[model samples]
Every structure is written in C-alpha cells, then in structure tokens.
Target: MPLRASLRPGDTIGILGGGQLGRMLALAAAPLGLKTHIFCPDPQSPAFEVADAHTIADYEDQGALERFAETCDAVTYEFENVPAGTAAFLENRVVLRPGARALEISQDRLTEKQFLEAAGADVAPYRDIANEGDLFAALAAFGGQGVLKTRRFGYDGKGQVMIRAAEDTDTALERIGNAPAVLEALIPFDREMSVIVARDAAGTCGAFDVSENLHRNHILHTSTVPAGIGPALAETARAMAIRIAEAMDYVGVMGVELFVVPSPVGETVLVNEIAPRVHNSGHWTQDACLCDQFEQHIRAVAGWPLGTFERHSDAVMTNLIGDACDSWPDILRDPSARLHLYGKTESRPGRKMGHWNRITPHQAGNGSSGQKS
Candidate 1:
C-alpha cells in the first residue's frame, strides 16, 4: 500500500542495504529533516556511519527485522538482491516503496526479460540454461558466442561468463558454479545508455536526462549527460522508461539500462536491464541536475511531490573504483571537480570506492546537446 500521508521531517526511514548507495541515500535524507536506519549484517557497512541508527543483523533475522520496522515510517532498499522473504516480511508492516513485485521480476534475468517483453519493450534474445546440454543448445542458438549469467545475486561483472566457440563449455559452466543461468546473445550495439526515472504514489513521474555510459571489465566506468543520441532517440528511451515504471505501478526511482543499436534508418534502443533503485549511472545528477536521483528517490518513497528533473549544467561522473580513490588529493586540486567518497575502510579491485562529478557551463542553445565522454 502507498503512504497515507507524506512523511514528516522527523520520521525515520528504514534502508535494507548498507553499501555506498545506502550511504548516499542517508545523506540525501538528512537535509530534508529525515533520518535513516541502516540494516545489514556487515559491521563495516559504510552506510552505518552516516545513518542516524543502524541494526547489524542478517536479513533473515526475524527479531531484528521486527524491531527495525517498528521504528520507521517507510522502508526502501538500495540494492536489488534483498531476500524476497525479507521484503515480504516488511511489506505487511510498513510502506515499502516499489514493492515486492518489482523485486520479484528484477531478481532473475529470465523473469526480468519476460516482464519487459510483456510490457512491449524490446530486449536481447535470451534462453534459460539448467545444465550443460542446455548451455550447448543455447550457445548454438546464439551462433556460439553469448554471455552466461547467473539468475540471481550477480552484479558489477560477477556471476557471469562468456561463451566463445571452441571454448571449453565445461569450464565456462563451472565458472558460474553450474547455477541456474540465462544465456543472452552478445548484442553488437553501437553504445550503451540509461534513463533514471521516478514515480510517486499519485502516478506522477519525472525523468533525468539520458546518460551515455562506458564500462570496463563489465563495471561502469563513467556516465556523461548530453549522450550524443539525437533528441528523437533520447525521447524514445525516456518514454520506454516511463512505460516500464507505469507497468510496474512503481513508486520509486528506477534505472533503465539500454543498448543503442545502429539501424539502417536510425539508432534503436533495446532494454538491457532494469534496476529497481537509484542507479550508478544517474550519479551525475548529484551535481548537474536541480533534483538529484537520490533526493528524487527520497521524495517518491516519502510520498512527496516529485522534483524538477532539469539539468543546470553538462557533467561527467567517473566511478572511483578500488585504488582509483587514492587520487583524492589530485582530484581535490581541481576546484570544478565535485568528489564523493563512500567512506569504506578498505578498497578491493573492482569495488566502487567513490565517485566524482565534474560540471561545466551549459552551452548556449545546446541546452541538452548530445555529447559522449
């Protein structure tokens, strides 16, 4: 159910994950007079430092979940992998924005693809693989080159393997732990982009500018706004995101990743995947837009009116993965560089330690021009 009344300044919000996303969400809530309570099993959760309160317990801890829910006006999650039982447990007691249905669809690759296709959205061709035979057949179907990704609990290039013709299928399957997986045809796309949109209980929606993304080792490296796609294609992507939000009756921020395929007539956008929360690509909004993605999510979950999604400048946001954050001093030297660190005690390879957004004056008449960085 939706919130009966907008959350007041002092109402505490419960967050289900304690990563950097949760940290950012807590920070966004503070200025609005709202407080956050982070629940995670990890003692070193970065979000715990910024949250007003925290519970270090497993997601399945019944006693802990009850106590945490009792203190908040609403609950939301920073990541998609929140155990299904955990989400259902809270939905009955508190307002859980975006709800369980969105989680159910997005937690599995096959389910997400089916949901998108049913909603009339185009997606990459895919097949489910349960065993080696299934993998071999699916590989042949895709002409022997595709990506095999685990059905659940995978992100940032983890839980996946690439299938190349003549490669050992057994070795590839073992890499994913022989888990239930989906084989997606390796789409030869011209570029990748994403649209971050927010929807409220009243059915109102708002969308930020399209962000062209570049990835390295399957992890997002940078996201730049004014993604050089022509205005028409950009609008098409935005419209698709809105359609998805409405289809899910979604009441929070959603990140819709798309693959831009070059067609004979023009560029076409295909739904790559759906993230049911604020996205890494949308981080650029922190400095460039009047209402950043984090704040937009807070407003939606709190049942407040969605804020304007206008960009005041052109910006590029780069992820400070692993030791990349070691250059904090150098980044600080540039006055125009707006830096944000996740407050992690230590960093490992491919871990998102932090991100920085660099903004520039919006060129005259090119208000929303297309550019790639």
Candidate 2:
C-alpha cells in the first residue's frame, strides 16, 4: 500500500488549492524531475502561473475531480480547507498523503483540540459552544475571559471573537454568525513557536528546528530560528510533533503550532493547533537548511527518502503581508537577503504576498538570538 514503487521521473502530482504554497511545491518538484497539476476553483490562481498543468473548476464538480485525479500519481493539498468529498474522491482513485482524516480533524477547532489531547498532547481547557447560552457558561467558567472560535472555517483571526468581560457577550455569537464553536481559556503564553515534522511512508519521522513566532493583528509577521527556548524543550516539541503525526498515520510535512506557557514546575508546552500541510512557520527552513520544508513535503508525498534539515546558519523569515510587499525593491537591495514573492497581481491588507529570509553564519553560543531584517 506504500505507493513507492512506481514514482519515476516525470510522474505527475496533483495539488489541491492553487495558492502560493502550491506554487512553492511546484517549484520544488522541478528539481526532482516531477511535474505538478494544480486543481482549484479560482481561474486566476497564482499557482496556475507555475504549474505544469491546471484545472479550473469547483471542488464539488464530480467530473472535474475525476479528471484531475486521473492525471496524477499522487494527490496532496496546499490548504486544510479542502472539501472532504473532494479528498475522498481522489483517495479512491489516486494516492493521497496526510489523508482525509488529517483534513477532517484540522478543519474543525473542537475536533483538533480533542485529537491533540487524545494523542497525549497538552491543550488549553476548552468547551464546545453550540448556542449563546453555551458561550456564556463557558466564558464564565474560564473566569470571564476566553476566545470563542467557530469549529469550522476559522483562520487568521477570522470566525473568532475575544470575550474579555461580561459586557462583551451581548453580540458575540452574532459576530461569528452563530456557527458551532468552541471557547478556550486564553493562556498567557510566554512565547509562540512551531515545529514542522515530516513523516514518510515507512513511518520514519524528522522535525525541522523550532521557530519562535511573532504575530501582528493575528497574522504571522516573522519566524526566527533557534527559538529562544532551551534545547531540551525544543526536543520535547519535536517529539510531540512526531507523536501527533504517527497517531494519524500521517504522510507528508505537517506543522504543529505550540505555545510555551510558564508553570510553577517549569515551562509547559501546549499544542496550539495543527496544520495538515506545509506551514507558514516553516518558511525559515527554506533558506536556513539544505532540504527546505517545501521539498521535504514533496519527498514525503512522493515516497522518497526524507532529507536532512539541519541548519548551517541562523535565520529570520518575515512574511510580507498586504502592501508590505510593495517594498520588495528596497528589500532586495540587501546583498544577503533571499526574497520570495507570490505572483499575485492584486494586494490587500493582511494578504500574505510573500516572504524573505535573512541568514547569518551560525554564531557559537548565540543561536537563539535573531531578528527579522
């Protein structure tokens, strides 16, 4: 069942969601002598520009999904929001990595928290919110402070509301359109970090270095390598990521978002969320390590042996959100900066246009200290 035997040169891989991640995956595949076919509803998808072939049709269109599945040796998605029906259709035909169960678990907030906890991971206290009354009781249980997030379709601060006081609950449910939700106690985490782990067909696992993340307006701003955490804690994070992957029989690169919270005994690492596919936090690995995350993912899905991801230098990867990409000309002037721009024609606030990584030769005894350029 390990689809490893027939992946020769020029095999076509089908990718769902024609976005920047898909574009990066296609770019990575070229060196391995692979071709990519992109499938998405958007005709103007940026990935369409780089992929070897593409199908522009809605995910619900059975005819389109059938045609797309026939052309690829393996199918993987760039985003977790991929529809369950579409993934199932592809799985019955071609090979699908990090399969439908991974998408199903990550697509719902309540399910994700439960899955992580069952996999022996620490998670924040939470309760399902099916109605306004549930929200009131759950928020009160967390001492009048909790974040209410919709169980489905929530990302980048969307479909969520922060309740800081009793008075703020008046229209909290209305804000998210009264969708099924979950209320989580907000932990005053010391630092936000993430670990990207790859699990191949043989169940072998390897994790990239931790990234100490910084967010602005609920969007990731930068990820600095050699996270300020100690080595032992970093290992704990890596082990946690591997456990989660094995629990789901996951194949491909997955990102595990984590929170470092201080406790009386020591710093408690909590599972913040899981990304079923390649992630934003792992962008730093692209320049810092020889086997970047995008390529690692391609290798895993293609059933090739995973590569080493050890970094030779410290790196700071900053996401160019919205109009921030407008300064590309200025940013590219730095002789050492590596710039990556997603080929999107229009830019709006909070849109992730691209990113750039600045690396310095590894400094002895000062790996964790870094800032974005």
Candidate 3:
C-alpha cells in the first residue's frame, strides 16, 4: 500500500543497515523533528550514535525485526544488500520506501542490467555465468576483455576481476570464488557520471545536478558537480533517472551511475548501475544544494513535500577512506572546507571513514574551483 499521509514530527523512521549513510540519515532526520531507529548486526554501527533507538540483531531475526518494526512509522534502508526476505517481512508491517522491488532488482547485477534494458536504458553488453563453460563463452564473446563480477554482494571492487585476456579467465573466475557472476563488456567511456534522484509517494520527482565521479581502487575518490557535460547531456541523464524511478515505483532517493560514451554525433549515457539508497557520489549535495540528498530522501520516504533540488554552489566532495581521515585535523583547520567524519574507531584499509565537501559560489562557466586536498 502507498503511504497515505505525511509523517508528522516525532514519528520514528526505521533504517536498515547501519553505516555512514545511516548515520548521516539519522542526523538529517533529527533536524526535522523525526527520530530514527537503526537496525544492523554490527554492535559498533556508527548510526547508533545518532539514532534514537537501535537493534543489534541479524537481518533474518524475525522476532527482532517484528519488534523493531512496531516502533517505527516507516522503514528505509541505507544499503541495497538488505536481505530480500527481511525487506519483504518489514513491508507487511511498516512502510518500506523504494519498496522491495527495487531491492530485488538491485541486489543482483544480472537482474539490474536486464531491468535497465527493459526500461529502454542503454547498458553494457552482458552475459550470465553459471559455470566455467558459460564464463569461457562470455570471455570469447566480449573479445577476452571484460569484468567478471559476482551477481550479488559486490561493492567497491570487492567481488570483481578484470579479464584482460583469454588466459586470465580462470584466474578471474577464481578471484570471484567461481560464484554466479555476470560478464560485462568493458566500456570505453569518456567519463563517469551519476544522478541522484528522488521521488515521493505522491509520484512527485526531483533530481540533483549530475556529478562527475573519479574512482580509485574501485572506491569513489571525489565527486564534482556541474559535471562539465553539456547542458543537453546533463538533462538527458536527469530524465533517464526520473524514468527509472518512475518505472520502479520508487519512493526515495536513488543514485544512478552512468557512463558517458562519446559518439560521433554527441555524447550518449549508458546505465552502469543503480544504487537504491543515498550514494557516495551525491555527498557533494551536502554543501552545494539548498536541499541535500539526505534530507530529500527523508522527505520522500516520509511522504512529505520534496525539497528544492537546485544547487546554489559548485562543490567537490572527497571521501576519506581508511587512514585518509587521519588528516581530519588539517581539514578542519582549513576555513573554506566543510568536514564530516564518520565516528569509526578504527580506520582499516579501504573502509570509508567519512567525507568533506568544498564549496564555491556557482559560476556560469567555472565549476572546477574546489580542489581536492
């Protein structure tokens, strides 16, 4: 059932998966007089620090899930990997924004690609790999240069391997544990971009400015707004995002990563992947836009009016991964920089500790003012 009314102040919103995103969501909700309850298996979830309540139980814990759902007026997730069964169970008891259908489509790479293609979105050529024979055929079909990614639970380059040649196929498959995977033809693109879009229960939609992204070691390093793409291509990206959100009957913030491929006529965008929750690339909105992505997501899921998606400033967001956050003191010392640190005790390698956004007045032709430090 669709959400019939806006969630009033003081209503509790339950969040699945406790991480930096959930922590930020909890912070965003508090200012609107909304409370958050975080549910995750990790006892040291950073979101627990800001949330009004928390549950440290496994996702499959039925009793715990029911108890947690009873305390909230609505539910949303910070990550796409929330167990499908858990989401289904909660949908019956609480309002789960973006719905279980979105989760089901995004959890598997093959499913997500197929859904994008069916929706008239351009996607990289892909083949499903259920066995060694299938993998070999896919490698040959893609000219022996493709990425073999696990169909599920892969992120930040963890469950993927690049097959640069025929001889690398076995090694690539081994790296992924020979699990169910998808082989995607490597895209030769000009640049990578993402659009963060929101849709409310009322079917109203809004999209933030497209952001150009740079990734290092498979993790996002920085996101710059005003992507430098021509206005036409940017609008095209936004329209594609709206179409996707509408197709899924989505009711929250979604991040659609896209590859901008240069064609003879102009630039064409291809769907790379979809993130069902707040995305790393959208972090720049925290400082650049009147209504940040986090707040927009809260507003959407709560059945409230969507906030302004207009960006008043050009900004660049840099993620503090692992020990990169050790420079927090230096970042705080810089007056022009806005620092946001996730309260994680240890900064293990490749872990996203937090991020900072550097803002500058928006200029018509100058969007690259902020430099990553």
Candidate 4:
C-alpha cells in the first residue's frame, strides 16, 4: 500500500534505530508539532533521550513491535541494516518510508551496484566473491588490486580489506569473517563527493549542494559543500542522485556517494554507495541550509511538502571522532562554528563522537549559488 494522505500535527513517527541520526530526526520533528517513538534494543541509545516514547526490545520481538507500530502514524528507519522480518512486519502494519525494496538493495553491495547501473548511473566494475577462489580470480582480473568488502553490515572501514597482492587474499577473507563479499576494481580518481537527495510520495525531488568529502582510517573526516567541482560536474552529481531516487521510488532522504574521476571527455562521477537514510556527509546541511536533510526526511515520510534546500553560506563540516570532541570549549568560542554533540558517553577510538560545522558568508560565482537541484 502507498501513502494516501499526509500525517497531521502531533502524529507519532516510529524510528527503528536509536543512534544520533534518530536523535536528530526526533529533534527535527518537534518544531513541526510531531512526535517520535524510538525502538531499539540498546538500553542506552542516544535517541532514547530525545524521543517522546521508546521501546527497548530486539527486532525479533513481534509483540513489542506490534505495540510500537500501533502508536505510530507512520514509520521510518535510521539505519539501512534493518532486519527483513522486522521491516516486513512494520510494512504491513504501518507506512514505512523508503520501503522494503530500498532496504534490501542498500543492505548489499552487489545489489546496490546493479541497481545503480540499471538506474543509468555509472559504477565501478565489481564481481561477487563467494569463496577464496572467487576472490583470487577477481583480484587477478583487476590487476591484483581491488577492495574486498563484505556484502552486508560493513561501515566506517569495518568488514573491508584492500587486496593488493595474491598473498593478501587469505588474510582479507579472514578479516571479513569469510562472509560473502564483493571485489570492486580500484577507481583511480579525483576527490570523493556525495549528493543528498529527498523524494516525496508525490514524486517531487529535491537535492542539496554537492559535498566534497575526505576520509581517514576509512571513516569520513570532513564534508565541504559546493565541492568546488564547477557547475557542470556538480549538476551531473545531482542528476545522478535524482535518477537514483526516481529509480527506487525512494520516499525519504538518501545520500549518494560518488567517485569524481577524470574521464577521457572530462571529469565524471561514478556511484560508489547509496545510503538509504540521512548520511554523515549531509550533516553540514544542518547549519548551512534553511531546511536540512533531517527535516527533509521527516517531511517526505510524513507526506508534507519538501522544504527549501538552498544554502546561505559555504560551510565545512568536520567529524569529531573519539576524544576530539573534548575541544567543545574552543569550538564554542568560534562565533562562526556550530557544534553538535551526540549524547554518548565513553567515547572510544574510531567512535563518531559528534560533528561541528563552520559557516562563512556565501561567496558568489563559485558554481553553486542560489541554485536548487
């Protein structure tokens, strides 16, 4: 079934994961006179603090899910790795934004690449790795170089290894727990960029400015808007995002990561990964745009009109990983800096503690100015 009407004020929205994304979504909902119910098995979920209501139960707890679903006018998830059974149960009971198909495709690398290609987006060459023999053959074909990644549950450099030689294949497979994986041909390219796009039930699409990203230790380090990719390349990135959203009939905000590589004709982009929910790369929108990605996602799921994604400033967003968030005082001292801290204690290495956005007056003639994609 599809959404036939919009949700009204005070309606409850259920979220599947209780992380910072869910917390921010709940925060975005309050001003719209909406409420949120967070459901996660973690007792100390960061979202649990901000949500109006919450249920601490496993995804397989049908009884708990039933009670939670009945309270929500519509439902959306914060993460893409939702249990198929859990998503199926919710889909039958209430509206689930981005739907089951989006969840299924985004959960696996092989399926995601195929979907991107069919959607008319360029993607790197990749092969499914079912065994040690398969991995070795794929690596050999790719010039003894490729990225071996688990098909599911991999993020922030987890469940991934670089296969630079035949000798590295055994250890690479062992690192990923010998799970089914995909070996993608290495893309020798320029910078990394991502486009954040939102699609409503009525098929209206809105996309934010492109973000030029930097990564460290396989985790995102910074996302700078305007991407400095010039107008043509920027438009190409956004067009690719729109095509993907239309292809998926996506009903919420999504992040489309890309590799902006140099082609024979000119600089072009290849779709690297698709995140079915609000992305870390789009966090800059919170401070730069009038209507940020979180709000856009909520509007789409609730069947409301999309908001303005126009930016008034050029901004750089940096993730405060681990204990780096301890410098909140210095960050607060900077008048142009907007700090956002995820309410999580015990920050360990590689953990995403929070992020801050530094905004400056928009400079004109930089390719993206007063343009809404």
Candidate 5:
C-alpha cells in the first residue's frame, strides 16, 4: 500500500543506518512531534539509544524491510552507502526522501563528477582508472601527482591512494587492489570549502553560509563559518550548490565540497564532491544558525516550508575523534563550547566519537582556510 497522503506530527519517520548523523536527526525530529524508528545491521549501533523504536536487521531482509515500511510514514537514510537494491525495495512501500537517484549519484565518485559536469558546474579534471594500464595513461595525461579514489565505499581518506612521481605506479595500483576507481589531478588550492544547502519539493532553496574546511589525514578535523573568501566567491559556491540541488530535484539537504583555487583568471572554485544528506562541515550551524541543517533537512523532507538561513555568529567546529574524546571534561568547562557525544561504546583510533563547537564574536584571522597540511 502507498504511504498516507501526508504525515502528521505523531507519524513515525523511519531512518536507515545508525550513526552519529542519525542520532542528531532523531534529536531534531522529536521537538517537531515526530518519532523515529531506526534500522541497522549493527546491533550495537549508537543511534538506537535515542530513537523511539528500532529494528536490528540486515538491509536485504525482505520481511523486516516490509515491517519497517509498514511502520514508517517516510524513510530517509543517514549514510549514502545504503545499498541501491535496499532503497528500491523500501521506496515501493514508503516515501524515501532525497530519493534513490540522488543516492545513486553521490555513492559513486565517477558518476558524481559526471553529473556535476553535465550540470555545468566546474569540477576537477578526472579520468576513470579501471586497471593498471588506465592508471598509467591517466598519470601521463595529468602529469605528476594525481589522486586515485575508489568509485565506491570511500570516505575520510580510506580507499584513496596518492600517485606521486617517485612512488612505484604498479605498487600503488596493487595497494588499491585494482578497484574500479577515478584518478583526478591533484588541485593546487588556496583553501578547501563547502556549501550546505537545502531544497524542498516546492522548489524553495536555502544555503548555509559557506564554510572553510581543514582536514587531518584526509578526514575533516575542523570547519569554520564566514570562510573569509569574500562575498563574490562565497556567492559563487552557494550558486553552484543551488544548481546541483535543483538539478536533482532534491527534497532535502545536500553538501557541495570545493577547492578555492588561485589562478590568472582571479581565484575560482572547483567542485570536489557532493554529499546528498547532511554533511559534517555544516556542524557549525547548530550553534550559529537559526535552523540547523538537520532540522532544515527534516522540514524539507516532510513537505514543510524551508526555514530561514539566518546565522547569528561565526563559529568553529572541531571533531573529537578517538583519543580526542578524552578532553570531554575540559570541553564541558569551556562556557563557549557546545559539545555533542555520539554515545559510541568505545574510542578506537580515528573513530568519530563526538564533536564540539566554539562560538565567538567572529575574529578575522584565525587560520580560517586551506586544506589541513
């Protein structure tokens, strides 16, 4: 049977994948009078603690999936890696926000680049590296130094291999295990930034202030608002994000990651990637904006009017990964800090256990831009 004509406050929202993102989404839904039911393969998933209900089942379990569908007024996934087949299965019974097509494009690096280019957005120069021969050809074509990233299942520097001229090309390919991948020319960028924008079915769109991102070991470590790239470049990035969201006819939040490059044509931007759901970079919005990205996404997906994008202060957000969680007491003591813990069971190295944001009166020169060196 089809989903009810429209969701009411008491209606349940079903979420796929249980992680910190889902936890935040669940928290956002409650005040709006909606309850959440979480489903994930991991029985120890952290998100289950706060959700109104949960189901521990593999993504492919048809029986469990049908039950979940029957319970939910609509479905939205926390992570993009939800299997395409699973999405297709659930969409038959429930309304899946952001839609399967958006998920399909974002889950694969190659297809995402193709889609951006087709949409007339600027992107890094890339070529498919299907095998060793293809890698060699791409290396030759792009000259020294390119990034070889897996087409699927890559995040936070995993599944990515850097091809420097000094490194043995064959060995690098072996390290990557000959996965289907895309090789992109390494960008010489002044800074890396992202735009988190949301759109609804009514064609209304809103963009959070552009944020400058700093990475450590290819994982995002900190993000700050008022990226200091000046108004023109900021507007350029936001426009790019709006175009991508509208092109997909998306009905939720999306992130557009880009490189701020300096060139003879003056500084310009290149699209690095797109995230079809709430993004890590926009975490600062929790303290700085009137409506956080999570709530904005919920509003859009529920067919409600989009919220205003009013940012009250400039803020800096830092991820508390692994041993970083040990500083929780210190973080709590700081009056300027707002902390969020994921309720994760253990703190393994490099795991994203939690994060904290510091809201201050917008200082001008605080190491604001550039990819982490």
Candidate 6:
C-alpha cells in the first residue's frame, strides 16, 4: 500500500543505525516539529544524544525491532548496510523509505556495478573473482594491475587489496579473507565528482550541483561545490544521477559518485558507485543550498515534495577527522566557517567527527570568506 498522504508535525521518525548521519537526520526532523527515535546496537551512539527516544539493541533483535516499528510513524536508515532481515522486519510493520530492494542492490559492490551498467551508465570494466583461479583469469583479462574489492562490506578503502602480476594470488585472496570479490581495471581519471539527488514518493526527482571530492586514505576528506568541470559535463553528471534515481523508483536521497575523464573537447563522466542515502559529498549543501540533503530526505520519506537543490553560493566543506577536530576552538572562532560537531566523545583516527562549510556569494572573488567551524 502507498503511504498515507502526509506526516504532520509531532509524527515520530524511527531511524536505524546511530552515528553522525543519524544524528544529522534527527536534527533535520526536529525543525519540522517531528521527533526522531534511534535504534542502534551501540550504547554510546552519538545520534542517541539528539534523538527523542532510543533503543540499544542489535538489528536482529526481533522484539526490540518490532517495538521500535510500532512506536514510530515511519522509518528510515542512516546507513545502507543494515542487515537485510532487519529491514524486512521493520518494513513489515512500518514504512521504510527507499525500500529494501534499493538496499539489496547498493550494499554490494558487484551488484551495484552491474545495476549501473545495465541502466546504461558507464562504469569501470570489472569481473567477478571468487577464488585463486578466478583471480588469475581476471588478472590476465585486465592487464594484471587492478583493484580487487570485496563484493560486500567494503567501504572507504577497507576490504580492498591491490592486485599486480608479481603478487601471489593465494596471498591476495587470504588478505581479503577469501571473500567473494570483484576485480576492476583501474581507470586514469582527471578528478572525482558526485551528485546528490532526491526523489519523492511520486517519483519526482531533483539534483544538486556537482561536488568535486577529495579523498585521503580512501575516505572523503573534503567536497567543493561547482566542480570545475565544464557546463556540458556537469549536466551529464546530473542526468546520470537522475537516471539512477528514477530507474530505481528511489524515494529519498541517493548519491552517484563519478570519475570525470578528459574528453576530446572537454570532459565526460563515468559512474563510480551509488550511495542509496544522504551522502558525505553533499555536506556543502547544509549551508549553501535552500534545502539540505538531510531535510530533503526527510521530506521525501514523509510524503512531501522534494525540496530545491539550488545553491545560494559556491562552497567548500571540510571534514574534521580524528585529531583534526582538536582545533575546534580555532574553527569556532572563524566567522566565515559554519561548523558542525557530531557530538562524539572519543577521537578515533579517521573518524568523521564533524564538518565546516565555507560559503562565498556568486560574485565574490576568491571565495566569500573562510568561516571556521
């Protein structure tokens, strides 16, 4: 059955996975007068601090999951890796936006790549590798040097090993714990870009401006809006994102990461990966756009019209990872920076604790001003 027309203020939104993403989602819901309930296994989940209610239970805890579903008007998840059965359980009782099918396809690298290619989007050439023989075959077919990524559960540089002609296939497979994997021919790309697109229940889609991403150690370090790509390629990136969303009948925010390759006269983009929920690359929109991706997602899942993706300014968003957050006081004193802290207590290395956005008016030269977070 289709969801009821609209969710009024005071309606509670139940979110699975409690981290910075869930925390931000809860923050966005509150302005609309909606409450958020967080369900996560971690007792110290940062999102639990802001949520109106919370349950510290495993995703597979049926009794706890059922109670959570019964208490909220609707449900959404912060991460794509929520156990499949957990989603099935909640969805059986409540409306889970973006749906289980979306999760199933995007959570696995192989499935995601196949789906994008089938939808007519260009993706890096890849082959499935399950064992030593398969790896050898893939290496021979792809010139011996490539990225071997675990077919499931890999993200931000984890679950991946580089494969070369000289490397032992048995050693590489053991490194990844003998998991199913995919080997892709590494592409020489000029730069990386991402599009954050939102779709409402009616299937109306809206896309934000392109964001050029910077990665360090396989983790996103910063995202700059108005990616220096030519106008034509920018439009192409947006269309690819919209195509993915519409093809999936997606409801809520979806991110399409791309590799911008140099074309004859300009540049062309190729799809890299699809993130089925609000993405880190769109963090700039929080201060620079009319509707932030978090709120846009809430609106979509709540049966409201998708919000505008128009940016009010050119912006740079920097992530505060681990010790990078130690300079919080200095960042806070900067007037040009809009700072956001994830409310995490520990300073683990590579952990995304917060972000700061520096926005400059369209006509401002050299950027508006450096605002400290």
Each prediction's RMSD over C-alphas, in Å, is 2.7, 3.1, 3.4, 1.4, 3.7, 3.7
For TM-score, candidate 3 versus 4, the one ahead is 4
lDDT of 4 by residue, 1-373 (tens): 5644589999998999999999999999999999999999999899999999999999889999999999999999999999999999999989999899999999999999999999999999899999989987898789999999999999888888997776887799898999999999999979999999999888989799999999999999999987969898998889899999999989999999999988899899999999999999999999998999999999999988888889989999999999999999999999999999999987999889899999998888775643334
lDDT of each: 0.89, 0.88, 0.90, 0.92, 0.87, 0.86
RMSD of 5: 3.7
lDDT ranking, best first: 4, 3, 1, 2, 5, 6
Runs off by more than 4 Å, candidate 5: 1-5, 362-373
Tell me the lDDT of model 5 at 61.
95
Please name the candidate that would achieve the greatest lDDT relative to the true structure: 4
Residues 1-373, candidate 1: write the lDDT tens digits.
5544479899998999999999999999999999999999999999999999999999999899999999999999999988899999998888898799999999999899999999888898899989989988988888888999998888988999887765657688799998999999999999999999899878898688899999998999999888878788888888888888888999999999999997788889999999999999999999997778999899888988788888889889999999999999988999889999999988898889999998998766453432211
Q: Model 6, 60-172: lDDT tens per residue?
A: 99999989988888899988998899888877888889899899999899899889987888898899987888888888888877888898888898999887665555588
Best by TM-score: 4
**Residues 255-314 of candidate 3: C-alpha lDDT, one tens digit per residue:** 999999987898899999999999999999898877888999999889898888878888
Model 3, 345: alpha-carbon shift in Å?
A: 1.0
TM-score of 2: 0.96
TM-score of each: 0.95, 0.96, 0.96, 0.97, 0.95, 0.95
Candidate 6: residue 49 lDDT (0-100): 92
Clashing pairs in 3: none
Q: What is the C-alpha local distance difference test score of candidate 6?
A: 0.86
lDDT against true structure, model 3: 0.90
By summed lDDT, the worst window of 10 consecutive residues in model 4 runs over: 364-373
Candidate 2, residues 1-373, lDDT tens digits: the string is 5444336779988899899999999999889999999998999899888889999999889999999988999989999998999889888888898799999999999999999999999998999999988987888789999988999999899999998987778888889998999998989999999989998877788888889999999999999988898877887888898899989889899999999999998997999999999999998888888888899899888888788877878889999999999889987898778899999889998889999999888767653321110
